[model samples]
Target: MKYQPIDSQLFIKNRKNFASKMKSNSLAVFNSNDIYPISADSTMPFQQHRDIFYLSGVDQEESVLVIFPDCPKANHREILFLKETNDHIAVWEGEKLTKEAALKTSGIKTVYWLKDMEKIMFELMTQCDTVYINTNEHYRANVETETREDRFTKWLKERYPAHQVAKSNPILQRLRSVKDPIEIDLMQKACNITEKGIRRLLNFIKPGIWEYEIEAELMHEFLRNRSKGFAYTPIVASGNNANVLHYIQNNQQCQAGELILLDVGAEYANYSSDLTRTIPVSGKYSERQKAVYNAVNRVKNEATKMLVPGTLWADYHVEVGKLMTSELLGLGLLDKADVQNENPDWPAYKKYFMHGTSHHIGLDTHDYGILTEPMQANMVFTVEPGIYIPDEGFGIRLEDDVVIQENGEPFNLMGSIPIEADEIEDIMNS
Candidate 1:
């Protein structure tokens, strides 16, 4: 791992919190993500399953965690199963975690080789009446691959159909939504790294530069700061390309006097930080570009203030729509007649400003949080509002990661990164 090892106390506290929510006599399971294959003798990078990483701080493959708070034996209450390391394997693949290292990493004293999992879990399962299965239930989830957790769930069910089964995702969704202090610090670090990347681009961006070059600059900054690069696939769209919401083919040449919409973030210790900043390729925005940029910035600012505790997700977006409507009307994108004749399903502002105003962000770019539920303190969200004007040949999106506060307005984590029109202009021209 390029990032330093996280404090195991975070995992300890997470496990304790999760254990408290488990049903009586129930055991929960978590599995590490598979090292996926690309072809013979080639494999995609190993990415640890977020849930397993959340619970155990074990960032390696072929690992499992089981928690049975009701177990009679103290050691069996929390157990970690790691792939055993041998001399030949160590020589070929580098050293795996020693048992002592695993204990330090996870704060679990009981460690067993992967070979012993079935025998030990069978004994523990007999003692527990219910089992908790992990699943991907994030609102944006569109998984097609049968994950490691899925295979384990199938095996567990087939082996013990008589046991009552429960979903762990619901419990995790609620818990992970509320950030731990350490998790917040890690997220802050990721945001800080993103800020470095953005600031570097502010000086480097110029006419005729390739969009991919900007992506490379950001990746360079992130890696030097001990990050594993972007939290998600970066979008370095310029001009008309920015109109495409998920544009990631950063192969276009940034023409002079065109706007570049950079939607990117750095990932530190597997925690994500999302940021979007639209700027001029030539370091100076045209009058129309500046107008659209300010409008989107205004919407982002107002929308961020609405992310207070108890704020409903649907209602918040509705309020943001109203805010955008007023801005679009001011910009003459929508006149009185346009507003009057617009359908309720898709408002007049939809032509200029589309996409949700915000989304939960953390370990995953779109992290787990129940949308229907009210916003709470310590919950991090991305306030991103954009105006895509294809006819005008420019798009503007302003996004900032913010933490909902217990009182007053939510705190912007990227607050000091410079988003205002004048501020961005000064930085680029300086």
Candidate 2:
């Protein structure tokens, strides 16, 4: 891991909070994500499962965490199972976590090697009446690949058919949505890294630079800042490519007058920050481009204010749609008749600004929040509003990550990054 070690107290608090919510005589288990393979000898980079990292702060693969609040044996109550590390293995593949290291990484003291997992789990199963299984139930999830969690769940169910099964996703969704002070600081670090990338691009961007070149610059900045790079697949769409909502080709040469829609962010300590900004390729927006950019920025600013305590995610988006509609009308993209005759399901603003204005942002880019529930203090969300005009040959988007406050407006995490058209232009021209 490129990032520094997180304070174990954060994970200790997270485990305590989660354990408090578990049913009596129940044990919850979380597994590290498998290292996926590409071909014969190559494999994809290992990413620890966010849930396990949240609770245990163990960032290595082939690890497991078990939380049993009512265990008869005190040492078995909280346990970690890790791949055994030896001197020979260390020489070949770098050092895996030593038992002592695992204890330091995670606050859990009872650590076991993977070779002893079956024997330990068998004993644990006999003691607990209920088992909590983790699953991906995020609102936007469309997972087709069976994950390590799924395989563990299948085996657990088949092995202990009589045990009462419970879903951990619901509890995790609620718990992970609200940020702890430590989590908020980690996310802020990620946003700070993203800010560095954006500031670098302001001076580097010029006519004839390839979109991929811009992506490279951001990657370089993120790596140097102890970030593992982009939180998601970056979008460096130039010109008409921005009209395609998820354009990531980033192969085109930037033209003098076109706008580049950069939907990019950096990750630190497994926390994610999402940001989107549109800027002129030539370092100066035309009159029409300036108008559209400001309109999108205005919509983003207004939408961020609505992310207060007690606001519903769905209701907030509806309100944001109205703000976008008003901006679109002022931009001449929508008229009174367009709104009046528009379908309720597809608002008039859909023509120019289609995507949702905000989403939960934290451990994952699209983090785990139950949208039906009311927003709460310390919950982080991204306020992104975009206007795509194919006819005008450009698209504009402005986004910022914010923390909902109990009083006043949400706190903008990316406030230090320049967003105003004049500020961006000034930095570029300087």
Q: Name the regions of candidate 1 deviating beyond 4 angstroms.
A: none
| Candidate 1 worst ten-residue window by lDDT | 284-293
For residue 154, model 2's alpha carbon misses the true position, in angstroms, by 1.2
> Each candidate: what lDDT?
0.93, 0.94
Q: Which candidate has the highest lDDT of all?
A: 2
Q: Please, what are the lDDT tens digits per residue for candidate 1 over residues 65-111?
A: 99999999998999999999999989999989879999999999999
**Per-residue lDDT of candidate 2, residues 280-373 (tens digit):** 9999999999999999989888888888999998898999999999999998999999999999999889999888888898899999899999
Instruction: Check candidate 2 and list the clashing pairs.
Output: none
Q: How well does model 1 score by local distance difference test?
A: 0.93
For model 2, state the Cα shift of residue 296 in Å: 0.7
Q: lDDT of candidate 2 vs native?
A: 0.94
In model 1, the Cα lDDT at residue 170 comes to 97
